[model samples]
Target: IPTIKLNNGREMPVEGYGCWKINYDRVWSLGSWLFNDDNRAGQVVLQAIRAGYRYIDSAYFYNVEKGVGHALRYAFRTGIVKREDMFIATKIWNNFHRRDRVVEGIRRSLRDMGLDYVDLAIIHWPMGFEDGDDVFPMYWNLSNVPREWSRNGFVETWQGMTDALDMGLAKSIGVSNFNIKQLKVLMDSSKIKPVVNQVECNPYYNQNKMLEFCQQNNIVMTAYSPLRQGYDLLDDPNLRRIARRHNKTAAQVALRWNIQRGVAVIPKSERRRRMNENINVFDFELRDDEMKAIDLLRQMPKLLTFGTTRSHPDYPFHDSY
Candidate 1:
């Protein structure tokens, strides 16, 4: 696997396994068990590592770090891989943005993942929610904003993240779902700059301007939903045509496009075969025309807008990136 050199001098894998929506409770369902062939997040993560993925992306919101940690321990015991080589990353949830709560948030995630330190710790989103035990505090519906918002600004939350770095809880810290303006505010106020900005980037929502901005600032841009989470991009005729030319799946082509653009992708999948396919794009390179053809998809609507939080003060999608 290829690695991207982060601003903090850390090397991160360009392709990674995303553990987002792999709910621990849902793994017991018949569909999950049948397709995944493993009922635990650890099993799935183990399968991913076996499939040649070196980067594993997880988060507090995913609620499966314990299972993921179980897999990591098993892998280590069996000599499948070493902890230092595997780039493990997690996020600080919105509810833990206060300077005082920041250290506690990462500590909880570390305890859940059974790790002394994470390769990367990211601010999950720019917005800060009511600080409490609830993940989505006062969130009763998806279509409306939450009832309460945290008074803690992202800068304050970043101060807590810096503390985590100072205390050796996280190797490097970055942000997710932040826009240009938000990035500037944090960059201006803090001495340590963000190494990367993770967001929902795919063919439909290309994030061209944001990519340019991050590149100019020497910040790597990571794509979380690189495959759009479903068949929408895979089924497109243009993408399929390019895939056929390269003898790769549309999913591979989609991922390669992001990789060619210098963006790291964390595509999630429960099946082992798909995991293999996702990490097998290093051999083939998309031609210039092929990349431009995929670029035509920039107009497609965003799949994960997080629009319900549009009214929140820290909502990132409100700006035109």
Candidate 2:
């Protein structure tokens, strides 16, 4: 796998596994019940490790920290991968954005994951939500509450994030779901600038201007949803034509295109074959023309903008990129 040097001089794998939208059937069902079913989630993590995936992305919002932790401990005990070889990344959810609770939130995640520290810890979203809806145990619903209620708290929360790095609970810290303006606020107020910004990036939502901004600022950009929520880019005419021309899978072609642009990608899958296939983009390269063709596809918009939801009052869409 290729590597990108972060602003703090830490090296990160260019392509990793994302464990978002993972459902643990026993613990969660169609309605409001919580149970325990760690088998499938545990197996997926182990399979990812066995398939040579060194980087793993998890979040408190995912509600599978214990399962992830159990799987990691099992993998290490079974000699699947060494501690130094793995890069584990998790996030701080919105409700814990209060200044006092920020560090505690991270500590809780570490406790849940059974790890002392994580490679990268991110503030999950720039905005915070009220904690009542039970979307995830830690998730607060922002569906109706406006952004103004949480903006100040969000900044305070970031200060606590910086403090986490100072105290050594997280090696490197950053933000996710932040737009240009939110990032600017962080840059201005922070003692340490965020080393990375993870956001939704794919052929449909290429985020060219955002990418350029982060690149110019020396902040690493990690592309989540690289396959567009499995919307069948693999069978799409343009991507498939490009894939055939380059002798690659559409997924590989998409990942390779992002890699060439110096963007990190986290494409998720539960199938062992797809897990291996997602990481096999190191050999092939995309030409300039093919890259441009992918770029043209970005003109068609897809996916929700991070802060543009009706619930966020200060959505940065009008003011910033």
Candidate 3:
């Protein structure tokens, strides 16, 4: 796996296994945790690690940290990888944006994962939801009604992230789903700049300007949905042409496109075959024209807008970036 040097001089794996949408079955109706001993999620994580994945991207919102933790423990005990050998990155959820909750959030994730510290602990989203146990506090018990937003700004949350760093809870800190404008505000107000800005990026919704901005600011750009979940980016003619030329899958072409642009990617897959394919992009390279051909797909509509939170004051996608 290629590595990207963070602003803090930490080297992060260019490609990682994302843990989003894992163990959703445990999240009964999105209301509570079942707390069963089903380690299916951990087994998949272990499989990913066994397939040469070193970076594991997770978050409190994922609700599978315990399973992921079990896999990490099994790997460590069985000599698959040491704690320092893997780069584990989790996020502070929106409800945990308060300064105090920021520290608590990471601690919770650490506790769930059975780790003392994480390589990277990022703000999951710039917008904060109402602080409470519920990830999404509903309004008037109506699921479709507008969710409550927190008054606390991310600047305050970043301060807590800095606290997490000061206390050695995380090796590096970052923000996710933040636009260039929001990043500027946070950078201006905070003492330590975020090392990364993770967002949805792929051939379809290529974040060209955002990537340039983050690169200019010395921040690493990471793509969460690098493959555009549920959408077949592999069906695109340009990507298929490039994939055939290299005898690679279109998914490989998409991931390679991001890697070639110096953007780190965290593509998720429950199946081991797809997991192996996602990380097998190191052998081939994309030419300039091929990269441009993939870039043309940026005209397509973005896959994830998180439009439910659009009314929030700090919603990021409202900006052009």
Candidate 2 Cα lDDT to native: 0.80
Tens digits of per-residue lDDT for model 1 on 19-46? 9876545332311232332237888899
In model 2, where is the ten-residue run with the lowest total lDDT? 135-144
Q: Model 2 clash pairs? A: 27-35
* Candidate 3 per-residue C-alpha lDDT over 85-181 given as tens digits, one digit per residue, 9 for 90 to 100: 9999999988888799999999999999999999999999988877777886555533322223443388888999999999999999999999888
For candidate 2, lDDT tens digit of each residue in 169-196? 8999988878887888888887688989
Residue 69, model 2: lDDT of 87
- Point out where model 1 deviates above 4 Å: 24-39, 139-152
Candidates 2 and 3 compared by TM-score, better number: 3
Which segments of model 2 are wrong by more than 4 Å?
24-36, 131-152, 305-309, 314-320
Q: Relative to the true structure, how large is the alpha-carbon lDDT of every model?
A: 0.86, 0.80, 0.88
Point out the higher-scoring one by lDDT: 1 or 2.
Answer: 1
> Which scores greater on TM-score, model 1 or model 3?
3
Q: 4 in model 2: Cα distance from truth in Å?
A: 0.6
RMSD in angstroms, candidate 2? 3.0
